[model samples]
Target: MNKIVQIDPDQVEDVGPLYAARKKVYPQKVSGTFRRIKWGLMAFCLGIYYFLPFVRWNRGLAAPDQAVLIDLPNSRFYFFFIELWPQEVYYFTGLLILAAITLFLMNSVGGRIWCGYLCPQTVWTDLFYAVERLVEGDRRERMKKDASAHRWTLERISEFVLKHSIWLMIAWWTGGAWVLYFTDAPTLVKELVTFQAPAIAYIWIAILTATTYLLAGFMREQVCVYMCPWPRIQAALTDEWALNVTYRYDRGEKRMSVKKANDLRALGQHAGDCVDCYQCVAVCPVGIDIRNGPQLDCIQCGLCIDACDNVMKKINRPTRLIGYDNDINIQRRIEGKAPIYRIVRPRTIIYAALIALVGGIMLYTLATRSLLDINVLHDRNPVAVKLSDGSIRNAYTVRFLNKRGFDRVVAIDIDGPQDAKLHVVGGDSITPDRPMIVLGRDGTTELRVLVTAPSDRNPEKSIPVKFRVTDIGLGEVASATDNFVAP
Candidate 1:
């Protein structure tokens, strides 16, 4: 007994414009516990990024000596003592999964901690802001200079030039450091200085430099507010218990001047501790009023908390009017109850367990993975040929990888078609009775091979064939399966 409902598609109107113009945010600077933490983290992150490529590891003479490198030319990735082959790309997949789960776990306990603290965008933007503050002055002075019409004095012009020059230098270094991960850092540096590096290297550096300059210098908060999808995702993933930078309206309502609040308290009337100062908003990188409750524009950076706490201290009142808080805590405060924290909840536990499980699996696989590998592909045309000696012959392309540091002699054998003999097409060193070839150190070799079986012992149609390759020096064996066909 349901009524049918129909509407014309054209009848619906578009609600509103999909986008809005951006407002520039000139964030004021503040200092406190969070600021100090930010400074330390920024230094650590930038130091590792810029200097780690130069750190050498003793990886013998033949291999790259850098601690970490992606040798695209050789199709290898070297990380300290560990080396990865092209077939082992799944390790990167596992690492990506671990990183995602770790981010989720971090979010379940502390909302947007990645965005507020560790995100590359935030770190670079913070560095750029530090440079800007150093050259142009603090928030108020910068704002005043921008607002005045006749402010472009020689000193201002000089500051502008200096600030931009420094920013460009930092950006160039950032790009330059990235290229070091692909080659010998010292060698590449020498080549780059002498204009002898490859054109592609220069192209990549230029692209990265432009992006870093634009995104960190000009886009800044705009990238956090409008461009990034993490804020939206974090909002969806957050629970009531996830601590975020919050303004406690319970203690901040009925905001007034300090004298007015004191007079009201003396008269036995309620007056909020907030002095209606806009310091919190002023220092916010996104220029959001945290007092207006949770908003997507708020990055939970904790700068407002520092600004509000400083203001509260100046007024001789209780601090932490703004702090790392949650909705449940806010509600508890409203009901005159102590706030509770539940960091070990179901979601957090699940995320942590997933991270641990994936990490353990990856470690186990890496520890026991085979260093020798083989692959076989049957010939496409004339898969089987009748030999003049009344024998059935089949051609194959065999590829083998030697993942060890030294050379290896691998003996190849076939396990199908009775009385079958193996032969390498152009290898003079391989014996007709027991075919073997030398595999180079840490490389792959492809060779054409043939298998012949007597007509009396040949299979009728197609039969499963197993190609086994045994390393004579290391006693390691690898096998691959293909099909043997008879004409």
Candidate 2:
């Protein structure tokens, strides 16, 4: 039998708060292969974003000349040579799928490569940090300034103002560049400067500006840790084989000073290379100690690797105390075996294959897509009408899409019951039985059409009716099928 004992109320310990206040992180600047790579990528990304709007593509007269534009008013999306109508929204869907698969493939090979190297947040935040470092000084200087009791000195005030001003300018330009993609870039720029641009454009610019300033300038790593869903997603997607910014504990355990490590090694005792300098933590953008093992907060940006490598070089130890490595390699090193890498594994292969397949399909469809199209909608109120001449008639609204750069004449014809007479309400026939209509350049035109069948030939049940529109000059053809019903 067990005896039940009652605990005193005072003996119970108080529980700690569930949430902790955010600590300000001041990431130090470091330079290495990864840092150079990041700088190159940031420049490339920003250059394309800020300047691509000004690039022009010759799409004939009366068409948008901007290389990339989202002509929302005209319900069109243009990218260099490709033009997409609203009906081709599936292309966007395919693009989204391709992006997701590429991200997965990157994650499967190297953990959070997108978050580390190419994420807009990471790039912008890095830029903001650079501005901060330039204005306020490096990690130690900034920390000393912030920690001082006299927080409002003249020099400090000037630094704060300068840093924030630069940040705001960058944010504003980022917003401005986004709006340029929606219209004629040079015209919009002039209108914007003259204060004659549309209110909606200014409103969007303001919204984006505020968000970019807040997220990149102040939120910084908090955006990566608590806000972005990709970190959590990549955490789940990462595998043991994936290379992450990791500390090789096998070589860096038993942290001690360089002098002590040297003495131990000389005495024929084991001494790990790590010196516990905290440089890795100092240079981390997310303020995580990679030595503490993989955490969700670690973006795997590899700055810590640079810091550790620098330290190792100074201490006369082998570099890469922290490097792009996996748990499997760490274990293999501990077991006195050579490290192995598997970049071409099953998951990565699958992701690559899927991306290729989707990309191929989209390219093929775009290349072979029809320039002319038609859609037919049957009249609802009266499905069929009985004419005075003992004939059955069906009315339809036919919409013709001419996706060409110039106006074209198209002849329309209908095929249904034998001896069917086709008539366009406001159009004249270029031929005896086919009505011809002029289609505007890269536009849609709708017409009311009537198809009449003789009473003797009219079907008792609804039958299929096909409408064909043929371009008179190019001989391009498009067709739509509806139904012909008896009165």
Candidate 3:
């Protein structure tokens, strides 16, 4: 038997709500070194993204002229002078490894620099903030308008409509620009304007438009804080010596009013340079106060440094109360010692070495890669058959790849059992042992081949047979090996 126990409501303590509602952030505009750098990078990145597809490269008559194109229909990827096939997907793997190592190197040098300066989210969100500031006034005015009694005034409503219209237009064009990479840019643009483009193109445009608008225009910093995985990964990758956006609390402590601080300093009492100004918080896009120390929310964008510098200049105090600094520097200042930076540490050197090794390997392989290639698949149903003439025959499906822009004639030769004769079922042979086939430009040709050998020469067990394809004119060669078995 168990006794029932009851808990009184009065004895229970309220732990508050499980979730906190999001606080709207209104980032104030500021101009300084980092801001200027962000502006320049944003322009450069957006320019490349919007216009790169229009650049053309001549790849002969039958090949695509687009400088960079993913030709899904032909299973080809063209990048300027280089063309990749499905079998060469190892190049993509190499590229991904290089990218990951580069990111790690960057993190080891500066915390979250990519997220702050180069992320698509940061660039587009900065653009959206500019538009918001232009239409609804700066941070304070926007806040006031939102809190005003007449929230939906005619003038304000008109501004809202204008702002959203511009945002949608930018978002739509962003999506439209992405689709241009798949086809001829100028031709696709004309077709799109005339509503004659493919249904899939329009569908992708719609999807990208919706995502860009929602993410850049509205979601803003939320995407960086919650949606992205880089922050967590960077946290694990970062070291104590890595430079990050930090408030120099050693110099900015014992906060007081600017006038109070000046008076205290005159009396030989120590007062920090910081005057308790909230400007740093106001200019931060993520609304994180750098003085609270580094947080997961901080993107290390250095906007707070700009904001703090502006305030320090106005108050006749030394700048850099907040800056890109490491924890070692902060502790050194407290210990009355000089701060040192070690950008060429062990991890950074290792990352750099790995990047170079991988890059060099890829470059070497790409430069020496063969344009002519072959694959051979032996028939499974009847591995080998003995003919009435006491000859053993083996069938194989051989494929020849002509990666060149022009058609080529290739000769297929087999090296296997003694006294073997190679024959292409429907192909003409330049010699009795070698069968020649014409391969079309930038395509593959499949042929049914029979390799027959005298029964006495056939091995009791399976033997390795090599199929070699040689370009008749250029003498380029590629080979593949398959087993020839006796039934």
Global Cα RMSD, each model: 4.7, 2.7, 1.4
Tell me the lDDT of model 3 at 434. 65
Highest TM-score: give the candidate number: 3
Q: Write the per-residue lDDT of candidate 1 for residues 308-412, one digit (tens) a residue.
A: 999999989899999998988888998999989999989988998999899999999999999899999999898899989989989999998988877889899
For candidate 3, list the clashing residue pairs, or say none.
Answer: none
Per-model TM-score, in order, reads 0.94, 0.97, 0.97
Which parts of model 3 are misplaced by more than 4 Å? 428-433
- lDDT of model number 2: 0.92
Judged by whole-model lDDT over C-alpha atoms, candidate 1 comes out at 0.90
lDDT of 3 by residue, 1-487 (tens): 9999999999999999997667889999999999999999999999999998999999999678999888888899889999999999999999999999999999999989999999999998899889999999999999999999999999999999999998888899899999888888999999988999999999999999999999998888889889999999999999998999989999999899988988998999999888888999999999888899989989988899999999999888889999988999999999999989999999999999999999999999999999999999999998898889988889999988888999898888778778788889887666765678789999998889998888677756787899998888999999999987777
Candidate-wise lDDT, in order: 0.90, 0.92, 0.91
For model 2, the superposed segments whose C-alpha errors exceed 4 Å read 1-12
Error in Å for residue 388 of model 1: 2.0
What tens-digit string does per-residue lDDT give for candidate 2 at 180-283? 99999999999999999999999999999999999999999999999999988888888899988889999999999999999999999999899999999999
